[model samples]
Target: MSHYKSNLRDLEFNLFEVFGADRAFGQAPFDGIDAETARDVLAEVNRLAREDLAASYTEADRNPPRFDPVTNTADLPEAFKKSYAAFMASEFWRLDLPESLGGTLAPRALWWAIAEQILGSNAPVWMYSSGPSFAHVVQVEGTEEQKRWARLF
Candidate 1:
């Protein structure tokens, strides 16, 4: 844990000062989401990454996913599961997704910045959680019926 650290300072500075992302607010697609709200979301996601996600890096490595014959699916280690649960509770995955898919529809810069906290905290988590991200993209480019189905993911 001591070796892991998140660059929230640079992130906020880039969003507000260097880039002046605040001006993007109160507009279509990004309406109702001001600078303060975006900052708050970033802060919370960072906290969750540090407190819950980064907390188990070493342990989760030792305990990898295993095969569950009865379920015919891989059972994620309890350590990983714990971290996954923490991430799911935060629901930060919706930050980058479109509003049609029940997401915030935030700016790509801010969305990816916030995502860096979670995915960078645990690389494996990003790989495992690719379903939602993929679903979001498909929902955006896919047909109407396909978008409806992607929502289930």
Candidate 2:
């Protein structure tokens, strides 16, 4: 039974004490949101990641996915599939996305707080799901449609 350690205390400190993100989230896009909501979100993410998500890691590794040359697709072990199915069932990816994109309007700093847990656990998994973070960058640099695609595509 392996466990991953996340620097949640540091994240909280940065959010509330250091960077004062709590205050920032209280205005504009985060006007209605508060530090308590951020803490609740973090706690939930931590519990899910530690309980449900971590349960899949060892099983998936012991039985890694295999690529099918004929089908041009990979076939993961049944165990891995089942485990990942449960993982996706958690809807971890949809945590802080835009409501239009089926996500809640959580502050970016809060998202970072959640990310630290997932990243600390399986860095590659975190790396693979960089769409939201990258989309933020692209939206800043890209045209209006491109920004729209950040949510659409």
Maximum-lDDT candidate:
1
The digit string of per-residue lDDT tens for model 2 on 1-153 reads 646765667878888998888886657776656778778778777776676556666766676667889989976556445544554566656655655556557677877787777765544456546566567656667899888887754
List ranges where model 1 is wrong by over 4 Å.
67-71, 143-145
Q: What is the alpha-carbon lDDT for the whole of candidate 1?
A: 0.79
* TM-score of every candidate relative to the true structure: 0.86, 0.71
- Candidate 1 clashing pairs, residues 3+ apart or interchain: none
CA shift of 58, model 2, Å: 2.7
Model 2 misplacement above 4 A? 77-87, 127-153
| Candidate lDDT values, in order | 0.79, 0.67
Candidate 2 lDDT:
0.67
